[model samples]
Target: MAKIEFAWELGAHTGHVTTMLPVAAALKARGHEVRFLLREPHAAADLEGAAEIPREGAPIWSGPTINANPLNLGEILLNFGYHEAGPVKALIDAWREQLRASQAVIANVAPAAHLAARTLGIPSFEVSQGFHVPPPAMPAAPLRDWEPAPRARLEAADRRVLNSINQALAAFRGNPLTTIGDLFAGRSMLLTYPELDVYPERGPSDYYGITKSAEGKLVPDWPVGDGPRVFVYLYHYYKGLASLADALARQRCSTLALCRGVDSDIKGRHHGGSVYFAEEPMSVSRVLPQADIVICHASHQMTAQALLAGKPLLLLPTQLEQFLITRRVVRYGAGLGIAPEVNNPDYTSALTALAEGSEYASKAREFSDRYARHERGAALATMIARIEAALG
Candidate 1:
């Protein structure tokens, strides 16, 4: 049996952890030794106590960014410790130790993990939504077409990011990547639908469509009420939670909310109303069918699920990645993107707009129809098949 390691170097949230779990489990089932290396070990809630989060971790860059408004994937990596060699080396070295210790025969990795594996000449493939695997051939295509940055600005950002990567390469006695995109160029297993892709410039690939969240197994059990069925999948402590929850109750929408860490007071305030709070993670598979409109941070999995179910969306983006995904959803007219930072954001209005329109629902169905024949768990099955083939 071969020892294989799956690694995630960046990003916050259970989404990354949850998305990779099933694939890891599948490999383990096949009698291959499998392990996970996550940026945030604690996010591995309870994976049947089999999930191991290494104490020696991947470098998570939270310091001041050289490029605050990243134009593309290359620039985005710049913000996350790619602007300087010291940080990049530190990040890569951290991943090196973990990969080395695992004695990894093969690797399925997110960004930094792959870089570390490359330095050690470890063969690997990427498993993610398309954003991280930037196209080296087309280096400067903007992430959002409507919000294009100046070419000079992009080049400058790329230079810094690439220089750092090259410097780190030098330290590892590796060849330098010619362009910023080359830093992330490699074999990728994209896990999103076509329309919801973060990188429009990335064109097309063999997508491994999405699977259900590994965090929760329970199907939704919404409270009975007489209004638009809205599914809330945002974080409990999000700034807009109070207003959004209150608005859902005030609007009398039959809401099934899964605010993972929601407090008692908020639940209390909405008590006796139509809002039902799921203290645990609820299956997106179950929630999507029952939802008239999906409200979330526009994470790829939820967005894909809502679209696949032909349901409209009211997006509340909390970060760059979520915002990027939200932009794609809105661009397709499948949803509306509302930043969580908006002053007392109008959740009620967004909900009403999505609920009141057939246009958004229609756009969502276009996505659903496109992949109407997609077999459930086919992506997971295909991924395993590829790995097994490669093993042989």
Candidate 2:
């Protein structure tokens, strides 16, 4: 059996790890030796069995706002140390050593890994959400709705990062990348998000759809309730969540919230109320099947789950990535987006409308049915076939 390596050097959340798990597991099940190169090993404890390549350093991007200049994408990678000759050389050496015996590498938003793989003459592919991959050609207006950065500003930024990357890549005799989008370019790309959420300029193939999180298996028993069930899943923390939780508690509906950073002291105040907080990880798959409507941070995983289950969403997105997904949900008429503020009347109004109306529910169900028509695991199968062919 051919050995395969999966590399992830970017992204700070469990989404990067979870996004790759299913394909890795499926490869193992097929009798191939699958390994991982991870930045956060502790978070990926379940992947302990796989051989590892250590990763270091922090992500460069921060905050809820995004600068959608095509060149800003390259700058983010360069700032993260990819343009440093010492670091790039060290990474190349590590990848060459680990992947020397492997047949192929599949990277998830890990540009360094892709570069290293390319340098070693090993075939590689990328897997990720659509927004992560910039389009081949920079659009006049890169970001939808938002004004584009000035051409001169974008050109200056792109030139600086591109020159640095080329200089660093030169040390290993790697081909020069012409644009930030080239970093993500490959013979094949497997997108984990739907077309509706993809950047307007991209033409990615059929999305594999959101893979079910393994945590979905270990969710605790669902709370016993007959009232309209609301499942609130956030990114561990959000601004003004206490008030939002309070609003949910007072809504006269059964609310179950799974938020990681919320302490029991805060939860205790709402203990006897209709709202329940789970300090531990809960099975979204188990709970999503029963939710009447999902309140989330517009996470693709949860949003896809809610849509797939025919449940509308009340999205409170705090960051650009989540915000983009939220906009798509609204565009599809399957959900409403709310500002990340506490006690906003719009929040309650939207929730009341979603809870009391069937139009959103019907649209969500229709979208779900359409999405479900795509073969869930076919993309992985195609990827595996390509890997096997490349090795041969």
Stretches > 4 Å off in candidate 1: 47-56, 59-62, 101-109, 144-148
Model 2 Cα lDDT, one tens digit per residue, 1-392: 87888777766666676677767777777888777677665554433332333333322222332233233454455555554456666666666776788778877777767777788787887777766677655421244355555677666656665676677789877889887677766543545555355475455455566654546334544455445788988755676577677767667568888886686666888886777888666767778887898998876767777888889989998766777888888988998888554444455677789988899999999987887765656766776676677877
Model 2 gets an lDDT of 0.68
Model 1, poorest ten-residue lDDT window? 47-56
Provide backbone clash counts, one per model: 0, 1
| Model 1 clashing residue pairs (backbone) | none
Tens-digit lDDT track for model 1 on 263-303? 89998888767998877666667667878988988888778
Candidate 1's error at 294, in angstroms?
1.1
Q: What is the lDDT of residue 15 in candidate 2?
A: 66
Candidate 2: residue 96 Cα off by (Å): 3.8
Local distance difference test values of all predictions, in order? 0.75, 0.68
> How well does model 1 score by local distance difference test?
0.75
